[model samples]
Target: MTVNGWQVSGYTHLRELGSGASGRVVLATHDATGTPTAIKYLVGDVGADASFRNAFRGEAELLATIDDPNVARLYEYVESAQGAAIVMELVNGVSLRQMLRANGPTDPESALYVLKGSLLGLHAAHSRGVVHRDYKPENVLVTAEGTSKLADFGIAMPVGREAGSSVTGTPRYMAPEQWTGQAATPASDIYAATAVFYECLTGRPPFEGQGIIVLRDQHASAPIPTDPAPPPVHDLLRSGMAKRPEERPQPAAAFLDILEATAVAAYGPEWEERGRRRLAERAALLALLFPFNDPAGGGTAVAETVLTESSGFGGPGAGTAGLGAPRGRRLGGAQKALVGGGLVALLVAGGFGLSYASLEGDPVESSKDTDAPVVTDTPSAPVDPTTADPTPPLPPTPTSVPTATPPAPTASVGDTPTTPGRTPTPSRTPTRSPSPSPSTSPPPPPDVSPPKIGRSAASPTVIEPGTCPYGARSSTISATAEDDRTPVEKLRVRFTYTLNGATNTVSMFPSRSGVFHGVLGNLPYPKVITRIPVRVEALDAAGNVGAGTVIYVTLNNYCTPG
Candidate 1:
């Protein structure tokens, strides 16, 4: 009822599609042209809420920009006298969620097919530099012909754009950095895609039984479900659902590749078409093996046709039409054996393949556990704790005092010396200082001076605003080193990107110091959030080159929750 009534004069609401906290969506038709579309109307006081309005406008703009075949296309966006409305392509089919409800978890082959199609759309969006902050089955639609498309970019943004005034993403699907109020990366998108895969294979998300914060905690600290998948889909889902973005496939295209490979391996080559054939063949065999008691039924009809065709009795030799006396029982017996054997073999092979594919590998090694410990070298000279940055300061005072000795008598043979060089030499014991254990201290051990090129606090990387946006064309980016080692004058970094079948590159430069720094300017627009693989390399005047930390990017809100 909330969806049927609308203020727009050009469109007539037909039925409810769905609703969320911000608005209600409905199926509608344009009055003049009679074209169908989905109309989303802002509900409540969202129009009065600046944060909400900004988010709504951002989403509308993103939807308007998408131009990919795999992504749901936005037709138009307009504000009617009643409220803001967005007209989107009306996908005439059920959400993947509904399908799952009606049919339980799908077979691995079917699931992968669905996932692959979705990734293609996502890649299109990523290529254009957009990230779909939210990606889930509810936003995925299957057409009457069974093609799948990704829907909704309500919270999507250009790669480096600052997030809106309000956090605009579904908590369940949000990445860890999102929850922690940190910027997201392409790896975040990889995490979300994998989450979808987990739900598809297990009929639920990877982490269950928790609120958003709890879920975030689970994402940040808990291990991905170590349990195996239902079948061949296991590898496909596991690889996509890796907790760390880097651990997952690099891009939607890569994800699709893995999904397709697994699906083909699981169901046998040409599994989709082959499955239909196998089903038909089995049905046909069943009819022959168990002919109906009544001559008018399916079993008898099938048997008679087979017998007539096999014996070349279609001509004059054909038996009388009405229940001719039963032909030799041998035909029934042989058919049963053949059909039974074939069915068993098919089942056995299918089970084996699925079991092999579904085997989840050992838990992945976590970065927290695997990263090289931070190395902090102590300054050669002791720094004053009060004036310094409140770190790496004075050593503790010695607690045990040396015992005092009595003055010695001078000019006596048995008297100890009391004057210079006569008193007991001060004990040469070196006092121990209270400080961080050797192993616990960061590089440049506590007592050692700072290294020639001091490492800065792992300053988190920054992605400038609008670099990645939802649903547009793709482009290339370059990153250069600007550290003590490579000065801006000598720095040169280049990289490439392909969108809608076009490719280009960006040039980057480093600063005076060697610490690598560069901005990957103006990425391509993406139809969905997608990941891009990037590698950075730095070189010295001597032609000696060093590799940089590998980082990945996605054009969407793919962040890990804090």
Candidate 2:
């Protein structure tokens, strides 16, 4: 009844597609146009909650902005006293996830086609200066016609906009910079695409490990593994997943050019047609599970196609098992897997090992361990879909935390949140260049004093209780950084904080004279009301760095008890 009654004005509910901690997704059709659509409904506590409502609206607005053949379109978002829901074009097909689970590795041409379609979708988003932060196998949907479309922009954000999330992507496909908690960029999307392509070429992701720490190290520092990919496409894999952003192709379209050339040369110009045929064959195998397909007796019910033992992306017991969630959960296998999208907090040790902590009713689990076809968004509330923003489903923190063990110590490398950019001038020779002319004047003694940085604090250190998984309200972070030689304007102050396992760094521009300020908002919600470890560092023109001592910021995550 909740599914049928949830408001989305002109759409008629056909069936419930999926449901999870975020909410329920239903298969619906337009009353006027008779076009099939997918409606994502946020109900119960989530519907009444302001934080979830805002995130849902935000994502809806994001979806409305792009119009691309390769990306699913947003029809509308609805909100009323009844509930909030997102209306989107219903692609009549199975998710690449389903296909991958049904069939092992696709042929080379098929993998190339997958990469091309995903890249084009990313190209459209990148044209708008947006980055699809979480691009993985599950996010790519393939229709019966063999066409692929990008799904789940729930975690996409504009370029250069950084959310201090623990880490906001599927680790198997995450870019190197994402592992270091850097903002998403066009290159980041390309890296993820290539990683997915690798998965299609081989049966598994390019880099696989037990946890995020190992994955993080591999993504950020390990050699880009090109050995697994077919020898011909090895170059694409290397360039796309390059450790540095600059090393990868510039925009999504630019990489698309490279992919086109590679495919044509390796598999001939008709490669896409062949690939699509292969993909269509794979989709045919799971035709019964497709939302548009109704079995002989009745409509498709989740129970009918409940993922069997070998069918789950995570194998068995991905959802409530291991996770200390309220035991006796009665959700079907598909429901459990689809609902397993919450992010588990990762504790980073000095040795790049994982240290997990216990969570309450709201647990965090690695999504890869419990992936499903559709990603139900985060828990959200009501909004006037006619005008409200969109949503971000649970910060793509797609898993519940594991055991009750103590979290590992905060990483000590907070002074610099990003990998050092380029080697420092390749080390100049000791034989210094001839003295500059009288006008140059010895470069003013090379600005020896690093900018002095003061302690940093976010105004309301406590995150709002209601912002469960999306993020905290915008809080202003202020710190003073001044250099004896460099003017206040010349000094750059960066505030770094490590929550869960990821490090978030914010650049504080000159607010006025001696002080620097930056607005901090939408931090991934903390599992416990503990302290977030942070520090402030400043850079001067001379490349000297000054840092403040590590400080603790209290997070009062006061919420309703179960």
Candidate 3:
């Protein structure tokens, strides 16, 4: 079956979201499971292009290997003699590009929040040796929940490998090495991310010109705009956009560290939460502008209606609307009816139109209203150092030992020389002695013990049921860790929970100081009892690892009887 002239057999096509140079994106639902998904297809002449086809397929393959909260998930890739299509998770949010255009520049805290998510996503790709060549605002999708995810891996390639001879990527955000025809590396990705970061701060790109050549030159030599940003952010922009690739942060993870430190120092400990809440508010406001019905269609009734009416496009009732017109002449009574029907379907079905065509230059369509509640700005209290556990120091280096001095040389004389001259006895050859061997220092003690995970607890072990928004149950998880031979470098908490019968996991960041503390907000679903299993991992400077005991928290909507 086909929906809107696109040949998709198992999935029912709802509407066209947008069209770009590569292909078109459409909203579709699976016939068997009834799952709503965004299908990107290489259509018409673009589908025939072998290179575009290969890239479309390549994007799906690359996405398959990545599974992170900050990156969009890929469901499946279908290819045929006619064209190619990629089925991916439909993020119900606005693009960062649109957000910037609508809201201008973001505050420092909000920008840092977005940057942190982007860097984590990029780090996931870099860990697998993949480089997102086209890292720009257009590819970042900010969901209604205030979570930012990286999208459009169409131009993504392996690290140290070139996509082709021709340079690819949005010129404004391209790195200096990319302009010079060098292979895309983690550093290059960092450069592009920083460019976006600059845009988030200044409401404009660092370098802009009339043509690609001028843009190239500007990126190669133009000084980064530090005047718009506060003093603390200047160093970040400078180091990320350094002219030489070697000077930039090698891997995205390294840059992420610097960004987090800067954010905390500038905005305080609760900076991330504040920024995310701001994004959530902005996203909610954006949703109000373009309201659409949910396409998932609660049951078979809505689904059947969409399928039956869409299939009747060219029937007797087809001419009743203006959809049957050959070209662009004029709409008659029947044409008007058809157009009206399609528009109604578009609105009711919540499918996107071609208005999202310009992916590179213009903003694209957002998803249906999530009805998620507005997150309030609640600053976290300052952590006390005296109560926190201290990190263990590394072992000392082995001391060196002095070598013994050689024995003093003794005088020697021949028997005949004594009678010839008294002076001859004085000139005796010094007896040779083997030089003492230098003492070798002992090897330093081996780092065998892993980091030690101390006590861990979650505040308010039980949450009241009926939270306004899914996943908004506010709580905090704190833990202490230590190492015998090295200082603790990082602490991470993984939360595993079941939402809508599917298991989902999210990684949470913890503060340093041999203690881990993070807030858990917004449960993924509403009015549902969820048991969240939490695990903590600590890593020392020497790479030793320690895992803490697992704990479970329950969300209950039921109240106990009096």
Candidate 4:
């Protein structure tokens, strides 16, 4: 809640730390010490709910009383009409969950370091009769030095026999008792911590499924996955994930002891020394391994060094090394002679066979006779027998035919004509061989028209941030273009902003309205009103250029470029 222009009464505001469905966290300076603190202010209905308000008070009291270095210290609690706010020590770190999402699962050594730190924090909270019901990666923060701090103790409950019946912790990290609507004890927190460990090893929580209901079943009944964790860590996760609270580690201190023991067992003197030695060895091994690791390193100096210096040869000699003897040496005198002789014999045989085939075939005579006149100009004539025999295959030697013939004998009107001494020709008509029919179908048409150029509509105009009065911090610039000849199927919009001598451009496309919107993120604009200059152009469907217009518009005081 806001009070006296400060979010929450106990501190003065500096900046917003974070906002969530639960509440907003703002960076503030403590009134007495002037030190930076994160004030979590829960406004509206959360202040009205007795249970939610009690949760904030309970967490504040627990954090204020604790002396753990890993826990966020609560300085004070404030109640006002705007909201209930808790002022706590500000943590300078990114969340472990964020790191995991960005970098994937951590290596075993890194995971162990984080787990050990979380265990230390949990142990301290447990000693003071407070249970961190939500012990997931999201609640763990890691500083620049890799130091981990367990955070988000706003829902932590005091140790007691009786408990409320509402479900609180994230279901994916919740224990079986939590899913079954049972009280969340220290054992429940232990189960949640083990869930985080499983996530670290597998890159996912142990009970991920289709939905919340399916996940609850998996967490409540499905077997904990067999992790590739070391033997000691495996046992710790197994003990912490037991189905029943009584069956699992009963206290957070017990869980912490197991984690500490596992860390000590895993981080042996040899392993620690090996890790350090590996860093030192990376420099030398960079020569032998780097080039091989990257195949594209061929043109690089590293590849040249590996091939030349490492192989005891220079440049081209390195390429030929160990590739066997020269080509001339590999082919001996006798084998070379045999290969040449065989090639010559093959060529001679092929030539002879081709010549014989050409002489034996009658292709020339067949083509010449294909359209020979059957009856000359008179439309009737005797067929030549020798020519009709398909130009009998040529003999070994060429021969010529005699062209001289006896004159035809004169005959009476009723007598048949015949050659001089030959008998009258028999009355008979020669049979004709079939001729191939010519096709009557027409050939396909050719395309000869010139291609037309395609023109696209100009992109939509960009809407500048600070042009609109509301929501100036998160604003968008838009641009649009339309074509008269053809419908605009695709639109492209570009946005450019100049800040501090550097110009940044962003491009976007909108599916509807042929418009494009460019969103500016976290950009602070001038707080005084000024004109924003923009360029706009349009192209028709036929690619004909339309009007190009430069526009200047007055923007909200906040949108002017700094």
Tens-place lDDT digits, model 3, residues 505-555: 544444423345554444534466667676666656556667778777676
**Predicted candidate 1 versus true structure: per-residue lDDT over 115-168, tens digit per residue:** 676788888777766676767666665543355667665433222123342333
Which digits, one per residue and each the tens of the lDDT, describe model 2 over residues 432-537?
A: 6698777844555556787787777564454443344322333445678778876666566778888678888976654323456554444455677767777888
- Pick the winner on lDDT between candidates 1 and 4: 4
Candidate 1 residue runs with Cα over 4 Å from true position:
1-6, 14-18, 44-49, 52-62, 80-82, 155-168, 183-186, 231-235, 272-562
CA displacement after TM-score superposition, residue 274 of candidate 3 (Å) = 0.7
Candidate 4, residue 304: CA error in Å?
67
Q: Write the per-residue lDDT of candidate 4 for residues 273-353, one digit (tens) a residue.
A: 333232222111111111111122112111011222332211121122221222100101111111222211212111111
Alpha-carbon RMSD of each model: 31.0, 27.5, 25.5, 36.2
Write down the TM-score for model 2.
0.50
User: Which 10-residue span in candidate 3 carries the lowest summed lDDT?
Assistant: 370-379
Q: Which candidate wins on TM-score?
A: 3
Residue 153, candidate 2: Cα error in Å is 1.2
